[model samples]
Target: MSKLSLAELVSMVSETKSEGILRPTTSKDTGRYERTGLAEVVNMQITSGQFIGSRVPEPTYLPPHWSAHIHPEGQLYFCRQGSPRVVTEAYLYRPETLDKVTGWIKRIEKLIADQDFPVSAELELFIKLEDEDCAYYLTISAFLPSFRFRSSTCFARNCIGTMSNFFPMHGSLSRGTLDSLVCVFMHAICDQMTSRVSTFPYSKQDCEAFVSLLKNSRDHLSDGNIVCTVARLWGIICRNRYLTQYGQENSRLSRDQAVLWDPETKNRWVSTVASRISFRTSDRYLAQLDDVFVDHLVYSDQWKSMVTGCLRDWRGASHGAFLALMLHIFLLALTPCPSLAVASASLFVASLLASTLLLNRYVPLQGVTAEQAMDYLEAVQSPTFKFQFVALVFALPHTLNLWGTLVLFANCIFMLATNFGTGFAAGISTVALLAFIAFQWTTSDRFNLSLARTHDKFRAMFFRNPDASYTSEV
Candidate 1:
């Protein structure tokens, strides 16, 4: 028998993938352009068909620390993440071009580094956005050190609080929060010379990263380079507006429309992004991107494959949390075995506390003020979880069977306390994993502060009744 060549094997695989089982007859799996062919168009250019040159223009000397945080995604941008934090008053209703807004942002970042904002600077600017950390993302990134906020969606500060809630980890939330100061407050703020810090909730990574991605170019971006590149990317997206699912009033431009930066599309895109200066004065610009398209097209990635990946991660997180919850209840049932009960309860309660705190942080509540945001932060910063742990313990046991469970619960808590010393190292790792997974699982919007959806999800999960899938715009 003749051995099959590599080419033959690949051809077979490609054919099989094209003919997806039970796929609609209308589907054309074997289109002329294959995945690799499309990738070549987006990622690589040919040098006389001999050598493949990268289409992306990334910088070469990226710091060792920053290397890991970089995601070299192409054909899309992170702006589509839909503004995770709060977009404060300054940016709203300001008909500023992308050039003007980005210039202002750069000025702020530069001033922050210099630590000296001149009196002339109208400096107070904030783009507040909210982000939900979810399960699959956290689990995948769990092994990083205490500063895992970027590497994992897990907030390191929560590890101690969650762990101490059930098992009394010798570590304090104050210390954990303090220790993770770099990740929480200082990651992306570093100079280009510093090691790269990972940015989490990947969708909302700074425009610096998005700039490199849009160029299909090198890593190790400078501030100037990032601005110019991102400006161009924004321009390109505008040029290709018809391609987007976003409904433009006149979707078809006859290569003659003069809007948003310049008479020609190419000039319009690049003119706004200035690396060395503040917002440039310009006349021709689009009136507004349709508000209806903002969430999906303007602020979020609209790719099908990426969309599918999101759903998968969302479900994984939810299931992971549900599993942890079930295990907690199971351990409650096993309270007769003090050692076993204490160990299992530690995992569940830690996860429960972590999820609760994440909910408090991300889910918006009516009438929230900046003061309340501070209050939330301070509450999480507390060094001890003893009160929370004891309160939770007292609440759960009596609901099952008053007398026997009460006795078992008392014995377990007592034994746990007597045996517990600050198991700081052990506590951090355990709770970090559990909290990361549980928090990510719970924060997806369907069940996140969404009363009706949360109700349906729990009922379906526990009662064998199913509900329609919920997908959020952000």
Candidate 2:
């Protein structure tokens, strides 16, 4: 395949009106360009083609090697999966020229890194916008490890009271959050010489291995030549999940799928990603990216197919269900009958809970055959077949039987009023008041405090003992 010069590729993207972010990795030989670092573009390049002999001066608004079309004023977003802190928004800059904007972004990255921001100084490029209002925000809002938050009093912190609910590993919510994290982690580990101690707790094995790898890289090259090893690692994860869908082993696990990322084999992966697929960068300067390197980074022969496939699947699966459920809930609210409305409300709440649990359970099992897992999940969650019961107690006159009696009594009073009986209206009024009071008392949350307490206490006992390990161990 003919390799594309950066300018030719940029020209093509400009012509196509593609929406993407260009991310390039730093290399040793890049000089003044090095300070320009990574850049973000919005939409497609406003213009393209070689500037070497062209009378037109290189567009000052354009970043050096990266371009994309995004709202220049929007915040820069950063994320990583499995890390305690995932989602972040950086200030966006609108520069006089696209190139200047790109330079400023790189400078900001260096500035942030120097300031000791928790995030890596390294660059990532992105240029995606939410197509519509969504109920679920998918970015690494879920999988971030503990300690990211300063207080446990906020709504999200309170919701994450237990670790089980902390990460929605699988489900529609997984991708925007977890996938971003995965990419972030790979970029940090591979491109930056950060250690686990400064950020996350790491095992000695991984730390030593990584340090040794870094040392070896330093020995082999200088002008800032970092190997694409980290990119290769990312390719492995992405491809395994994407191409062979090994991660979807529950559905298919053919030998073809398993062949996606075997570094040990003769099938050495190539870095030809941008050649095969269309990609663009964001204009958000803080999300610095180098287009040329990003092309190479994403185009690992070892796992390019898998990464692209994963993107397709993640996007398709994430947004569709979120939209459907939001619509369903909105529609359900229009129903009229109070009793029916209450029932629908209960159903909605139950459905939401069930979805959360199911998503949590599916995350870790992505790479495994899910026959037994699915069976277990179904068996445990099958409401119809599960042996369970609910007892509802109604106060006097509010009970189904009592309510029927009141209806009959009211009818009798109306019938008798036509005949005789002084003070009949008063009697009927008293009965009605008594019935209302009784009904209210029975359903009152205050009356159910004990029941709520019992449920809470029971769950509390199992709080730290997720997986029911205590029961088995005991």
RMSD of each: 31.5, 26.1
Q: Which sections of candidate 2 miss by over 4 Å?
A: 1-61, 69-107, 116-407, 410-474
State, as a TM-score between 0 and 1, how close model 1 is to the true structure: 0.16
- Residue 289 in model 1: lDDT: 16
Q: Residues 1-474, candidate 1, lDDT per residue (tens digit)? A: 344332232223223321121111111121212334333355555577675655654553321211111122222111211111111212222334333434433433443334432222111122221121100111111122321111112233433111100110111122232323224323333422253212121233443565345344333233333333333333333323423322655442221233233222333333334211111111111112122122122222212222233234334433454464565565565444656555544544443454445344344522344234335434532233212222232222211222223343455554454456436435654675698688766775755668777677787886553433332212
On lDDT, the candidate that comes out on top is: 2
In model 1, the Cα lDDT at residue 209 comes to: 60
Task: Compute each candidate's TM-score over C-alphas.
Answer: 0.16, 0.17
Q: After superposition, how far is residue 269 of candidate 1 from its true place, in Å?
A: 30
Tell how far residue 239 is off in model 2, in angstroms. Answer: 22
lDDT of 2 by residue, 1-474 (tens): 445433343233233222333222111111212234355433433346723432443443322332222222222333333212222222222342333333434443443344443442122222222221101111222222320111111123223221111111111221232334344444445433543212221233454565465444443322112222322333333333343333454422322222233222221121122112211111111011121011112212212333233334334433443453364454444433334434433443443443344345444543432234334334432234121111011011012222333333444454446445648766776887899888877787986997788877887787776457657777
* Candidate-wise lDDT, in order: 0.31, 0.32
